[model samples]
Target: MGVFIHWAGTAALLAQLAGAAVAWGADGGADGVVAVGVEEFLGSTGDSAEQLLRLDLDRSGTLRAREDGVGGGWRLRGSSSAGRIDGALLDAQGAMVFNNHYADADLRDNVHAFADDVVTAITQGRGLAASKLAFVGSREGRRQIYVADSDGERIQQVTSDAALKGSPSLGPGGVLMAYTSWQSGFGDVVLKDLRDGRERTILSAPGTNSGAAFSLDGTRLALTMSYQGNAEIYMASVSGSRVRRLTHARSVEFSPAWGPEGNRVVFCSDAGGGPQLYVVGRQGGAAERVETGYRHNTSPEWSADGVHLAFTGRQGGGPAVVVHDLASGQNRVLLARGEEPTWAPDGRHVAAVLDGALVVVDSVTGRRRTIVRGFSEIREPSWSR
Candidate 1:
């Protein structure tokens, strides 16, 4: 038997977690202190579920758990019975705000779903607690693809190629994954069905094939293929049966990422004498430069909302994660030192590699928390929708 959870709430918590002083409400008031009660469980499930829920809320950047003595705001309380956990959200006056239930054979999955629901009810925004991440990690001196929950738990290796692999991209809902592998002595794009553990070489063209990205619809892929003599951005069917070249630049073009609408692709190129960002249509056309005011920019990932673009930019002679507003043309550095950033489903946070560990950063508040570590080297984290 696994764990189950139920919760509900009416009022929302609009607070920002910053420094030691916690502020709640729209005006950053000291009132309305939010807290998560320790969950009571039967058997030996322990308090892991409660701890996970608390961590999820804290990482949201919109909520924090106040101490026991703190008063006001809403409180989350729950208990378990026969592997079933029932919970509710109560107002400061001890009145019920909301109630709901969740059941899954996997305890972690149940907790993640519950956390996501709580975040949505309070913040009116999507929660990444249940999202999935795919990245490249080294094992036995060989790099392979790995997957883990958004909280960096339940880590699973997806590939055992025993060869170098990189550029991992997860499809919509995380049912499919695409990555570049060197098992054939050439960079080839391999697609894997995460559920059934089945994989196939999707793009095995001569020269090198890499930088594969799934479209918003997951029906097509945009990648950089050099089989045409020079590396250029190309679009191919998910089965790799039909290929359409999208870029013909003399300078090498790679790291293609799909726009939110699936009609445009943003990629990195050295055509401007230095690595920079460019956008091209899905049907193939002249690329236009995306001025980031930086000498070097790469790994452009569009936010789910289609309003912002996250990429790696050179700052202070080191790599930094930068977010560029497509509408206002304003660029802000999210991380002082990080690279290969991928946006969370909510578009409010980003995951990147920092000092050989995976760190999630709140793009709005610039708050960072390390989620996954102890890997030899992690690179190119791709978050599922």
Candidate 2:
């Protein structure tokens, strides 16, 4: 076999690590080597609730989750089982000869291998920690909620139970949050006060109620309700109880995002055959096409300055996060593979769901990095207003 052992597979990972080191007589010799072993825990259920989140490892060449010799809960906890060391020497031939050393049952060998792959992964595209963010995730087979810093620090589970909860949309000034919860038989929108940790029910109906967004002045809220049959946009006073429908369409029109101007709202509709982006006046009026191209433009989020609108689009190829420039009437693809493109409060960057992980991106630079490798699926990551 070759000096350096390169093995990658869903089941071949563990065997290769242990086998590689022993073959090179790296068990215990003159020059010891660096080794590493790493394991990841996916989401697990009732007694064990049965919520299981698949590990979506983003790797190109040859990468797969190793399940042999590792057994436990939803975690990357395991012992370092194997090790191998490789070095270069000045041989007689002008070319450098690669030497391979293998260690038998070395604790450090697995760690060394882990480190090599981890470093290589980061250099590829995985970002280093920076800012913090709070999102919802399911654990132990239950649909709970969590808040983690943007860098995956201080991860705290906010809600504990089997009921579904998430879509933590921010308010105008970052003082409040509007989210949806299925604690009841139907989905209900709730307004949360960030200061005193108080929550109040804003709206509830018979159908799916979602996409709660606060207006610019923080005086009113725009959400989507399906009480009238199909989902439609609605405007409700921030502190008052009066609610009015903004659209009377017969199609499934929801996901209302308030525009920066505070006088208009953009939503997604399938009235024209496939799903597309549409705009309507705040008080209610005829809807206009805001974006064109794909029939699957959904989850519209207005930029802070309201110059552009970002939404999800699915062409024949795959799903992508795109931005629609209002003046130019052009659609720009920000991410080649992602969904739910939500603009930050500053509107300079976007937080999108890429490969089942949330990633922050600088739209102009076309660069992205992972936030953390947690959660089964992430959607509707809104910025703190």
TM-score of each: 0.83, 0.63
Output candidate 2 Cα RMSD.
15.8
Give the alpha carbon lDDT tens digit for every residue of 34-79 in model 2: 1211234222211110001012111111122233413211112222
- Candidate 1, overall lDDT? 0.81
**Which residues of candidate 2, in runs, are more than 4 Å off?**
1-134, 150-152
List the global CA lDDT of all models.
0.81, 0.60
Candidate 2 lands at a TM-score of: 0.63
RMSD of each: 7.3, 15.8
